[model samples]
Target: MRTHSHPPGHPHDDAHVGHGHSHGHGTDARRLGIALGITATFMVVEVIGGLVSGSLALLSDAGHMASDVAALALSLFAVRLARRPATPERTYGFHRVEILAAFVNAAALLLLTLWILWEAYTRLAEPSEVQGGVTLAVAVAGLVANLVSAAVLHGGQRDSLNVRGAFLHVLGDLLGSVGAIVASLLVLGTGWTVADAAVSALIGLLILRSAWALLLDSLNVLLEGAPRGLDVRAVRTTLGGVPGVRGVHDLHVWAITAGQPVLTAHVEVAGGADSAEVLVRARQVLRERHGLRHVTLQPGAEGQPCEQREDLHT
Candidate 1:
């Protein structure tokens, strides 16, 4: 509606927040940063314990924790970077940095899962003696730590991808820790060291499931796909229904940052119209009806509208 001139070089996020101040995103980033620091410190403690305990489950859990530390660190870094103003060289600012980091964190976990499977395969070929009691204790401690980290991040992750990545990292650690504990009990009470490797393999399967989804989501963002939850058809219909708008085209929706969605489109009206007024109305509709803020629309198309060739192929 009303155009407020930002300081000339200020970076803008066309993602979820629209043209409003990025203060909310900044505040959320700070919270995730604090949670990550806490998570990283405890992760180190768990890794050392796993190594000393001589338990593969504990070690596996520690591996997961190690990844969690890396994920959290990336998220923390992303939050800070996302706040930096945009330059002509990088106009969108650093919002998508969080998404890139998310992809890295997830890919790292998937690679680690493959490594775990390979290790489990080797162990299956030649089973080793495990210190089950020690493994159990370490696993318990790791579980407690993971639970704490998950709790700290739970609130924000639903709204922020940086926090969600960190949360997923902690959740994966929790799964590994629990598997380690069960394997330790089976080994100590029933003399089933093979169960340890079996459990690790199962945990690897779970990680694969998670990693596939993360990779796909991250790739979608990189491809500039429409933001996950937005409906393009609905958006087009809504725009066309506007009083002064006869058609809408060239509409695009994508992430400018992890949790931000940006939209750009063209509107065509049948008669002469005011671009400013149409822009104002379009902005209002996106924000109020669609929960979208980062929208750029050019009004007035007297004749034919834009068409997506991809649609014709379908």
Candidate 2:
């Protein structure tokens, strides 16, 4: 027998319905729009500059900027999509779209990194005479644009993985811009034009480093793994420690989207105790201590023979 009640302050309570999708949707969309516009405009400038200067580093920056444009646009679309109300057919609405977008952005960064590395190797082997003056001027401009874009996105990155993915793209562009500047100075000062490829290779390495973290995070989320920094065992211990909660079994916790965690568990209550109070305490404990809001708790008598008991560790 499942016994429970959603007391005041419970996230799943009636008064708080649909709050998940509505929170921060508009702000995220606006930030993404601004970032998209900036990335798209700079990408055009970089493309033309790369063609005119014949600088591999500049061309690579343009490529990274291009991906930034796509990532920002996709993030905006996802922010909008994630606002849809949950329905019978799609209970979670479009929450997972943000995760999917993050994954795509990370994958795009990896592919771009590989391409940049290959191009850098070829340029190094051939040692093209890149126009240092044009490279320097264009790189300075690209760096300024990327810095602005990064600032525009900085606020949202810490809170949302979707925003973080776009932010990472802009950071990659920023790295490319700095690389182009260094390479241009090297080529102009000492006539070592191979610096272009060397710096481009360095940019690829930096991007690969950041991209690997994002890819792993996205893959873990898609695999339904627990959110980073959340300890499931700790949560179980805390839940079990709730007054009248004899044991916590079948506890499961995972992120439905960035910052939105969902928890479901069967809480066993000691005999002759009010399971109602136990459920309330359990929910409150999770919310107050673990920062978990969307919780579905099933209360059962202690030592009850639950047939679905095998593999309960999850």
Candidate 3:
């Protein structure tokens, strides 16, 4: 017999499927708004400063700040969208919007970094005069603004990929500010205009590293890969070890979004075993051992014909 059984009397049920979507997002939205305002205001200033100073480092930092403005705005929109209730046609609601925003932000960062690198390369070939005094003053101001924005977003970043992407952008801008400051100092002290391009290139490399990591993480979620640090083989082994279970197959695990994992499996019970009791124990094991609360299990007798294709077993 095929039994579609869930854990009975479990506190976590379908109602809790999108728990993170509702709670704590208000704080996150507010944080994003604060960071957005700060970043937008400074981005314009940095652009003007870059133009007046003619410092490649300052110009590259301004470019990154521009991308930060966009990233923060997108993150704020995604946070609001994620609050929408699930509809019949869209069972998972708009949670994935956050992941999409993160992906887009990462892509933007990568592109901006590449552009900065190219610009720096050209500057290296034919160095230009940079106003070290103006660059230093503007870069210090930008650094202070970035510090405030980064602090505002840091609290929410660990909980949401959308927020994390914005945080990374702001952090990159912070590094760029530091690079600009260093370049300005080098130029003022030793008349080495090449420091401007060299420092800009270094900042681009740093941003590239962080952007690539965010891109991969968001891509994995979009592709429905298992959550990070979760082992499918370990989950299967645990299920097969459940008392009265003859075998386990058709097991699948994937995240709807970060911190929200879902699993489904087919379990074969020994002949004459109490399927209901076996299911309860299995659910308890999964919940306690593997932190899997959102689960669906199909229980059947040991000799029952496999309803799923053999190739699909994990």
Candidate 4:
């Protein structure tokens, strides 16, 4: 017998797969809008400040802030798209759009960082005059703006990869602002204009670190990899241990998005065991022990060969 279980009101409904995530969509959209506004407003200021101060650190931070604006806007659009209801053709709705957005944002950040590093290297080779006093004043202002933007996105980032990508961009800008300030101080105190190029290079490296992590996480989701921290072998072992179950096979687990995991498996029942009872026990174990609410199971007598192709077995 083949059986499937999902939360009440949505049988085999991919739309309702992640119940925990539904409640936060509205709040997440609101937060993204707020952060987007803050980031867009400051990006212009940073650009003009970079030109006036002639500081590579300031220009690099301004470049990062520009990318932040684009990242925040994309993240906001993804969050809204993800809220759309599922369709017959697109059973999972637009949830994957958020993952795609994160991937794009991470790639853009990586490219921008490389550009900043290259510019910094050139500036270091041939030092440029930077107005320390002006750079200091503008960098301090940028620091304040980035702090507010980072604070706005921090709450939602833990729950959504889309939000986390935007948060990382804002956080990178925050660090860049700090680096610009430090470089400005070094130039003012010791007349070492090279400090600006050095600081810009450091900021680029920091951005590379955060962007790489976001890229890998979003890529994992896009590839339908198992949810992070979930152990497929452990899940198989636990399911096999269920009372009346003779064995487990052809088991599979993968995520639809960051927090939603779906599982399917074939279970062999012991001789003379009730298949219905075995199915119920298996469902209970997966739900209680593994926190899996979306599941499908096929149960048969121990001696029966699985009808599925052997190559499909994991």
Candidate 5:
């Protein structure tokens, strides 16, 4: 029985360089800063407008924008913290900080949504006299601010879960702004004060949707679940089909962050086959087919005793 274990700094390590390292977050940080400024400025405006206009919708939007400010600020801090050098105690550096921030932002959004719904119910019971003119003007201004903030975050949103959480927050705010506008118009045309509470309820629903999605994604990563697209069964089948491979077992695939995936597996090679070639083929398949660059492959010849049996998990 021939058994081999690959070291972290093996000769083939270059094929999967930058395992846990992320680069070029400086641009993301700057973008987040700009978005943060826009959101904070509008948040103050909306708070004042909500107070003077007595519009529950406007106040709800302001509350969401306040959360957006926190989300963006946390995202920016995460990007900077992720750049710190890796340490012996924390080999993966602070990359997971961004994910943790995302989880926190999602939780905050959920809580805010619940509060908005409760407030909407109370407002519906005893409607307030909202100023249509002031509500309309303020909602329009908020809409513009939210649009700009969304544009600033859209690009980075696809690249990082942290940014995605922040983007979702801003998007929820944009929807809230739209709802506030519609409610204000309805109040102006028909004097239906109930429109304000109705809009706030709808905005809360939208926030709940986005918050649920972000929460699930962040929890999946934190729990070390397989990435969204990659199936563990398919991966094992693919590895088993590799030339000179007898079978595969103890396969694992998971994400370290939003875009980085890591894999580890034990492969059984045909007797007398070149284990080195099998190892290379496995790595290549993982990299090219699964988009997995960070991989650790252990090869064992047919009928060989599995030395890593105790450590292997399905």
Candidate 6:
């Protein structure tokens, strides 16, 4: 879907939401589906393997993978929901479902990381004798699966934050696999059981690092903060340069979904200029120059302030 592309003078409307783009939502869903499948399969194996091998780290990692399965499943459903037409009662067509999904995914990751850290702490306190070879074998399998998952998602990371978030999960898993491998080598060579526990701690830290970023990004989008790539001052500057536009205020920029940006503003213009023409030019500048399609431009007298500010302060 093309973005709002409406120039200055137009008010925010469903048009921006309606006309937004769907940058490869289908491919993204497919890749995530495959990744989730692999993760789920390995999660079961790792759980059983951890239990048999007596490795707390393996068990914790498996638990996190289970959550990943749920995340990917929800993301798949959200993507499909986003594509559906909005009903009479539900305009905006469930696009933000992905945003909600991102939030949940991030929160889940944090919780999972905390749990892993707890497990790591306990393991640190009492490093137990675990079958490092067995844990290593399972981890190797998980690594291959994670690599496959990452490959499937690599193509879409540039398009969707949702997709990028999923990719990060797999990437973390890959690193966890490496940590597991190292622990196994240490145990095999020197019977250092603490190495296994230490590696788990490292894995938890890595997972937590990625999770934090996702949490903030998802929250920002949900809060309707400007999209990550958006520049508020630059947007204001550009709008101010539009002919017939004297100044700008009440400017708002946000995302409806991945790669879809919307803007709304009050533009001070010549008292008698044609509102429509000024709006068209502003819309063109936003869309053609900056990739913002959803635009709302409110016209005002050259020296007047936005009616909103006046109303709010009065």
Q: If candidate 5 were superposed on the true structure by all CA atoms, what would the RMSD be? A: 3.4
User: Every model's Cα RMSD, please?
Assistant: 5.6, 3.0, 3.1, 3.3, 3.4, 4.8
For model 2, the stretches where C-alpha displacement exceeds 4 angstroms are 1-4, 8-21, 307-314
lDDT of each: 0.74, 0.86, 0.87, 0.85, 0.85, 0.78
Question: For each candidate, what TM-score against the reference?
Answer: 0.85, 0.94, 0.93, 0.92, 0.92, 0.88
Best by lDDT: 3
Candidate 1, residues 1-314: lDDT per residue as tens digits? Answer: 32332223434434335333267556666666666676677667667766775667777777777777777888878877877878899887777887888788888888989988988888888888888878888788778877877787787777766667777778888898899999999999999889888999999999888777877788788889987888988887887777677777778888776567777776775667754555566666777788776666655455754441111100
lDDT by residue (tens digit), candidate 3, 1-314: 33344444655455775665577678889999999999889888899999999988888888888888888889999989988988999987888999999999999999999999999999999999999999999999999999999999998888788899999999999999999999999999999999999999999999999999999999999998888888999999999999999998788898777777888888888999987788788888898899987787777788887674121111
User: How well is each residue in 123-185 modelled by candidate 5, as lDDT tens digits?
Assistant: 999998999999999999999999998999898898788999999999999999999999999
lDDT at 118 for candidate 1? Answer: 87
lDDT of 2 by residue, 1-314 (tens): 33345555433542253474476777788888998998899899999999999999999999999989889999999989998888899887788899999999999999999999999999888988899999999999999998998998898888788999999999999999999999999999999999999999999999999999998998888888999999999999999888898888778888878887888887788999887777777777887898877787776788985553321111
Error of 1 at 118 (Å): 1.3
Report, for all candidates in order, the number of backbone clashes: 8, 0, 0, 0, 0, 7
Number of the candidate with higher lDDT, 4 or 6: 4
The order by descending lDDT is 3, 2, 5, 4, 6, 1
Q: Residue 234's C-alpha lDDT in candidate 5?
A: 81
Per-residue error for 98 in candidate 5, Å, reads: 1.0
Q: Give the poorly placed runs of model 3, Cα more than 4 Å off.
A: 1-8, 308-314
Clashing pairs in 4: none
Clashing pairs for model 1 are 1-280, 11-86, 15-260, 15-261, 16-260, 16-261, 18-293, 18-294
Off by over 4 Å in 6: 1-20, 303-314
Report the number of the highest-TM-score candidate.
2
Regarding TM-score, does 2 or 6 come out ahead? 2
